[model samples]
Target: IPKTPLWKRCVQYTDILGKRLLKKIRLQYLQDNLEQRRTARSSNLLSLCRPTISLDPIL
Candidate 1:
């Protein structure tokens, strides 16, 4: 039955928007970390599979 003031509503909206943005940023950071780990693991595996050979003509 009572209407809220415009400034109060704006403050509430800004709070909600800030929380949502923080959540999105956190999720993106986690995803980037996961991807980095995955790539590092794959690179390790590839290095393990490939053998290093010397280019010198001496046997």
Candidate 2:
């Protein structure tokens, strides 16, 4: 079998690393959004008692 050249191997390694980094970033973003949603839900549950304002302030 022919061996991969050093430069080609390096390029492939960098590409794989770039893909992994991007996936990690995407996962982190998703996790942050999920946390934000959970927090908003908790606040909504709390506000259900008073019923003074809209549950969703943004609306």
Candidate 3:
């Protein structure tokens, strides 16, 4: 059997770590958004978003 080079092994390890970190961050972000929405839902109607406000991301 052939052995993987040291650099290739490092690359594979980093790839796995990167994917795990990405998944963790995504889950955290989703939870945070859900929590924020729950709080927002309980706010007074008068304190809600105004039509003039925009949340669009800049290109």
Q: For candidate 1, give the lDDT.
A: 0.58
TM-score against native, each model: 0.40, 0.40, 0.41
Model 3 lDDT per residue over 1-59, tens place? 12543333344456565766656655766786778777784655433556576678999
Mark the regions of model 2 whose C-alpha exceeds 4 Å error after superposition. Answer: 1-17, 41-59
Q: Clashes in model 3: which pairs?
A: none
Error of 2 at 38 (Å): 0.5
Instruction: Give stretches of model 1 more than 4 Å off.
Output: 1-17, 41-59
For each candidate, the alpha-carbon lDDT, in order, equals 0.58, 0.58, 0.58
Report the C-alpha lDDT of model 2 over 1-59, residue by residue, as the tens digit.
22543333344456465766656655766787778887884555545677576556685
Evaluated at residue 30, the lDDT of candidate 1 is 72
Ranking by TM-score: 3, 1, 2
* Pairs that clash in candidate 2: none
Q: What is the TM-score of candidate 3? A: 0.41
Misplaced by over 4 Å in model 3 are 1-17, 41-59
